[model samples]
Target chain A: MIEVEGVERRYDGVAVLSEVTLSLPKGGLTAIIGPNGAGKSTLLSVMGRLQKPDAGRVTLEGMHLAQAPGRAVAKKLAMLRQDNHTAARLTVRDLVAFGRYPHCRGNPGPEDQAQIDRALAILGLEPLADRFLDQLSGGQRQRAHIAMVLAQDTGCILLDEPLNNLDISHAVRIITLVREAAQALGKTVVVVLHDINMAAAHCDRIVVMKGGRILRHGTPAELMQADFLSAVYETPISVHELAGRLVAVY
Target chain B: MSPEIRARQITHRMALLALLALLAAAAFLLLNARGSWDFLLPFRGRKLAALAVVAVAIALSTVVFQTVTQNRILTPAIMGFDALYVLIQTGLVFGLGAGRVSALDARLVFGLELGAMVVFALLLFRWMFGPAARNLHLLMLVGIVLGTLFRSIAGFLQRIIDPDSFTVLQDRLFASFNAVDPGLLTLSALIVAGLALILWRLVPELDVLALGREAAVGLGVPQERLVLGLLVIVTLLVALSTALVGPVTFLGLLVANLAYLLLPTGRHAVLLPAAALIALITLIGGQALLERVLHYDTALAVVVEFAGGLVFILLVIRGVAR
Candidate 1:
């Protein structure tokens, strides 16, 4: 489990995240749905240990992220930020192989290679494995980044805005990959998503935030009411049952 | 390409560069040694070694620096090494007059320059990288500001100095292989080799670091500490090379970019040496060509700077910095 308590982060004395307390269970896909500047990414970043909080502490799988050794924490959890840019021309396989750096330290054994191969296979990245990242389309590059995290093979994975430039098909493929990783591999996956329908349709739980505070955290069925979402977004939203799943429209 | 094939290709390219560097070194030695074999051999050999050291230092520093900053256009040159030298030289001449400054022992002048550069690099970078870890663009801006400030101060000093003294000072300013201080050269080799020892361990981390700060940190590379270490190493190497020889300005830029273009990969293990070899080839080969065929009296720095400046502008025009 990942637990965050009283986490507060400020930029230039302005609170970007405030008094945020949340927990992610051991397994399953948890989508963080929120408006822009809702502090959802900030909360996730703190939980993943990407950005340190001004107050409070975060622990992953009972180990405090701040105090844990970097290698140890890396073995347990993986975090991917929104903007991953590089001028280095790296092949897909080369990029994915870096996931094992914490474990192998650049000298990969048979098992590390196996993990890399599995990551590539899981993401359907085999065909494009030899291609350079810059040569690939944005959706492909997004998947390649996702493949790298999956190759880390950690217990908990945090991804912010993984669907930024992905098309519907690739996005669905990625969600399915995340869901499968959570269900089959028993990994705790926390994804910050902007789309409510995708979160409702796929995630086991959705955490809603507004103005740097967590407003709601529940299963899709529990938070599927129109009034609840409308209140959270400060706009009129309607919820309807589509294909036995709650879909939100505004 | 797959890792194995790409790895093989990189090896082949490195071997090619190494062979070319060797050939150039041999040609430079043999062609330059026409009369008084004993006297010329050691003399030319020392000069050759000095050139090789400067080339390697500049090339590796440039590549490592570009990777850290994630900006291809930025180099250690931009960090004010040459400008700092000019400012110091001009200041010394302005205050003490040309005769007094020129009368100072060559060893004393070299020591002063080296000490000033080391202090300058340490002070400037210690504050530049903040706890929050400022972005690459901000760092570039700071370097440019410092360089411009140094240039302006040097300009002010040069304007007031007499013409005869100014000409003498200009000779000291331009990079000339004929005038390398043996004492400084030995000191530089030791310092650069020490930096290289530390960098050997950092090669793997640097490969990952080239992916940028967020990924490096996320993957457990300890971005802050690694970047600080790299900055220090780059600073020392740049200072050492600049003190040993007058600044080669774009030589590092030219060699590093060529290495990248020749071998397109993220592996620094291959990239560093490849860049070093390219630097060697450019320096030794160009030096030999100018000395033998063209019988050029101009400093090698002139040709290097001209070529490097052109490459810099091409990179900018191509928008490769992004």
Candidate 2:
């Protein structure tokens, strides 16, 4: 479980995240949905320990993220930010193998290699394992990044804007992989998503944010009402049940 | 390429570089030699050692710096190291005049330059990366600004100083291998060896750092501490090399890029040595060619800067086109 209490982050005297508190459940797919500048990514960044909060504390599984050893925290939590880039040219296999650095410290044993192979197999990246990241398409590179995250073998995974720039087919494929990781592997997965229908159909819970504050947090069934979403977005949005699933339209 | 094939190919390339470096060293020592064996061996050997030290220092520093900054077109020199060296030499001439500056002990002058540079680099970087970890782009901007400021000040000093003193300063600043201070060469070699040892231990972390700050931090590599340590190492190595020979601006840019292009992988273990060997070959072989074959009177730094500057332009254009 991740506990965030009174977390506030400011930039140049302006608060990007204001007195926000949230508790992320241990094992499920949780999607943070908000419009641009709504602090969705910032909240996720704080929870993942990518950015420190100015006012409060965050703990992952009873261990303070700010005080714990980086290696220990890494073994428990894995965070992947959007638009990953590297100066070094790395192959898919090489990139995934780096996920084991915290454990193996560059000398991967047989077990570490097995984890790498499993990640590649899970993401269907074995075919492209030898290809460099720059040689791959946008979707393929995103998959490669996810594969690396999976190779980390952390209990909790946080991804920021994983679906950005991906096509519908690719996006669905990635969401399915994320869902499967949560379900089959029992990992706590938090994803920041732009597509509401995809989140409604796939995620177990949804957290809505507006103006850097949490507007609502509940199961998709409880939070997918038209009035609440319309108010959260400050625009008219309609929700309809389509074949047993709630779909939102604007 | 498959891992096995790629590993073999890399090994083969490394072997070729080593062989070429050896050939260059031999040719540098043996070409057009007619003095007594005793005098020839020690004199040529000292020069060879000095060149090799500078080559290693510059190449290693450049590659490590580029990896930290995640930039292909940048070198440590862009942080105004070379400009600072010029400023130091010009300042000495301006303040003390040419004759007195020349009469001062060469080792004392070298010590002064090296100390001032290292101190300046630390202060500037501390201010940038101190209270909070400032972003690298801001750090780069400050470095460029300070570099331009140093250049302008040096230019002002040069304009006012007498022509004879100005000529003396120019000779001191131009990067001539023919005038390496022998007393300081041994000291530089020792310092470089120590710095290389520290860098070698951080190779694995550096490989992770190439993934950029977020990924590095996520993977349990303490990004702030590691980057700060690497920057200090870079400052020391750049200071050592620049004090030994005046600034050889483009050699690091040329050799590091060549290492990346030649080697098919990104592992720093392989890349660092490849860059060093290439630098060694460039300096030694280019010196031999100019001295023996063409009978050229120009410093080897001139030829290197010409080639390196072209490579820099090509790299920039290619990046933009891409």
Candidate 3:
């Protein structure tokens, strides 16, 4: 389990995340939904240890994340940020191979190579494995990054807006793959998402954040209501039942 | 672009670079062999060794510095390293008096300058690369400002000093490849060898570091500590080369970018050696041409800097720096 306790993060004098606290158990896909500037990404980064919290502490399975050894934390958890800019010109295979750094420390053995191959195959990137990242489309680049995270093979994965720049089919494929990882591999996956319908359709739980605070968090059936979303988003949003699944429209 | 093919390409490129570097070294040492072997070997060999040391130092330091800073166009010289060298020289003349400074052992003076530079670089990096000030643009702005300030202060000290002291200062400041200190050359070779060992252990992490701070941290690198160590190595190298041949501002930028262009991979193991060889070829090859072909009409540093400046502009115009 991951626990965030009274965490506060500020930028300049403004509070980006104020007194945010949450608990995530060991398995399942949890989707965090919020508007722009709602601090969803900030929260995810804090949990991933990419950014330090101004106050409070975060822990994974009784170990304080900030104080734990980096490799230990990396082996247990992995993160993928929104912007994936790199100065080095790396091929898809090269980028994915880096995910095994915590495992092999730059010298990949046969097992590490097998893991790399598996990651590439799962992401459908085998054909583009040797192609430079700059030669790929935005959606393909996004997939390459995702493949790197998957290659990490951690117990927990934190993805901040992973669906960005992805087309509908690819996005669905990724979400489904993520769900499979959560259900089959029993890994805890946390994703900050923008599309509410996608979140309702796939995620086991929903965390609704607004103005740097969690407005509500529960199963889809509990939180997917017209008035609750309308107030949370400050816009008229209607949640309708399409067939047997809930579909959100605004 | 299969993996096998890509690996072969890198190996072939490395072999080609090694061959060119060897050719340049041969041309430098054997182009005009009029003297006896005993006289020519030690005499020309000292200069060649000095050039090779400076080339390796500049190449490794600049490539590592760019990897850590994640900026292609910035070099240690542009960040005020040589300016600080001038500042220290001027301060010594102004404080201890020119007679005392020149009377001091040359090795002692080199040690003092190198120690002060490393200390100052550490402090600057700590201040500018703090958690809140991690923006590359901001760091570049600070470096430029600090560089100008150092130059201005050095200029002020130079103006106030007596004519005799000013002359002494000029001798120290004028960096010529034609006159490298033999004693300093030996010390520099030892230092570069030691730093290369440390850098060798860091090559793997360096490739990951090129991915940026956030990504590196996410991938389990101790970002702050590693960056400080890399900065220390960079400071030592820039100081060593500057103390030996003064400073070649754009040589690092020119050669480092060239290595990146020549090599297909971002692996520092390959990139580091490639940059060093390219620097070696540029310095020795240019020196040989200036002496043999050009008949010593111009300093090699001047011609190299001019070419480097043009490359800098071309890189900017090509929009590759970002």
Candidate 4:
């Protein structure tokens, strides 16, 4: 479980997240949905200990994030940010292999290699594994990055805007992969998504944020209400049940 | 092209290039070797050793500096290390006349210069790493300002100094591989070797770090501590080279970029040695040409600066400045 209490983040004297307190349960897919400047990425970064909160604390599985050794936290949690610019020329396989760094510290044994292979297979990246990341398509590169994060084998995985450069098909495929990883492997998955319909269709829980504050949090069936989303997004959003699944129409 | 085939080609080319560099360096050493076998061997041997040491220092420092800064065109020189070194040399002569400066122990002067460089680096990094003004351009601006300050101070001191003293200082400032100090060569070699060993141990981390700060941190690298340590290493390397044969700013830039182009792999393990070899070849080969073909008419620095500046401009045109 990841717990954030009284978390606040300010940039240039303007508050991005103010007194935001939330507890994310273990072993499920939680999609954070928000409009622009909603602090969704900031919250995820704080939870992953990538950014420090100004006035609060975060605890991951009874270990305080601020106090825990970075290696220890990294072994239990992995984060993938939106922008992944690397100066080094790394192949997909090499990038995925770096996920085992916290575990093997660059000296990978057979088990680590096996995990890397499994991640590649899961992402359907076996063919592209040896290809350089820059040589691959944007969607393929996104999948490779996801594979790397998955190869970390952390119980808690946080992805910020993982679908940014992905097409609809690749986006759905990634959403499915996240859902399956959470359900089958019993891992906690928190992803910041921009598409409301995808969040409604795939997420177990929906977290709605507007202007850096959580407006509503509930199962998709409850949080996908027209009025709730409309208020949160500051636009007209109609939620309808189609094919036994809640879909949002803007 | 298939990645496997590409990798093989790159590796093969890198190997060929490295071998060629070694041969070139060897030929330079042999051609320059003169006088009796005993006297010529050790005398040229010392110069050869100094050239190799300074080459490795400049190459390693430039590569690592580019890695941390995430900019291929930027070298340790941009951080004002070479300027600071000049300032120190000038200050030494200005404060304590040429006689006293020459009387000072060589090792002590080298230590003082190195210490000042490290402290300057630490302070610059600490300021840049702060939350406010986290921009790379801001750091670059600060570095440029600091370099200008050092240069102005040295110039002011030069203006007030005696003409004879100025001549001595000018000789010190001019980078000449032919006149390397044999007395300080042994100590510099040991220091450079020790630094290389420590850097070799950090090869894996350095590889990860080349992925940029956020990515490396997300991958669980101790970013702050590792960055500080790497900066110190960079400072030491730059200082050693600068103290040994004054500042050869563009040589490092040229060698490191050439290494990257030749190796075709971002892996530091290959990149480091490739840069070192390129440096060795350039220094030795350039010196040999200056002595043999050019008939020692012009300084090696002029050729290096010209070639390196052209490469730097080309890199910028290619949009690798970022």
Residue by residue across B19-81, what tens digits does model 1's lDDT show?
999998998888955789988889889989899989889998999999998878688888788
lDDT tens string, model 2, B42-157? 88898899889999999999999999889988999988998899999999999999999999998998899899999998987788778665777887888899999999999999
Worst 10 residues of 2 chain A by lDDT: A79-88
Q: Which clashing pairs does model 1 show?
A: none
Q: Model 2: residues >4 Å from true position, as ranges?
A: A167-169, B131-133, B307-322
| DockQ each | 0.68, 0.75, 0.85, 0.65
Candidate 3 C-alpha lDDT tens digits along B27-116: 888888887989887887898899899999999999999999898988987668888889988999999999999888878878888888
Q: What does candidate 3's lDDT look like per residue over A1-250, in tens digits?
A: 8999999999997999999999989999999998899999999999999999999889999999999988889898999899998879999999999999988888889989999999999989999999999999999999999999999999999999899999988899999999999999999999999999999999999999999998888999999999999988899998899989998888
lDDT of 1 by residue, A194-250 (tens): 999999888999999988888889998898899988988889999998788788888
Show how many residue pairs clash in every candidate, following the order shown.
0, 0, 0, 0
The alpha-carbon RMSD values of the candidates against the true structure, listed in the order shown, are: 2.6, 2.3, 2.4, 2.6
Q: Best by DockQ, which number?
A: 3
Clashing pairs in 2: none
How do the predictions measure up, each by TM-score? 0.94, 0.95, 0.95, 0.94
Taking chain A of model 2 alone, its TM-score versus the true chain A equals 0.96
Chain B TM-score (model 1 vs. true structure)? 0.91
Interface RMSD of 2: 1.0
Q: iRMS of every model, one decimal?
A: 1.5, 1.0, 0.8, 1.9
Model 3 segments beyond 4 Å from truth? B93-100, B160-168, B306-322
What TM-scores result for chain A when each predicted structure is judged separately against the true chain A? 0.97, 0.96, 0.99, 0.98
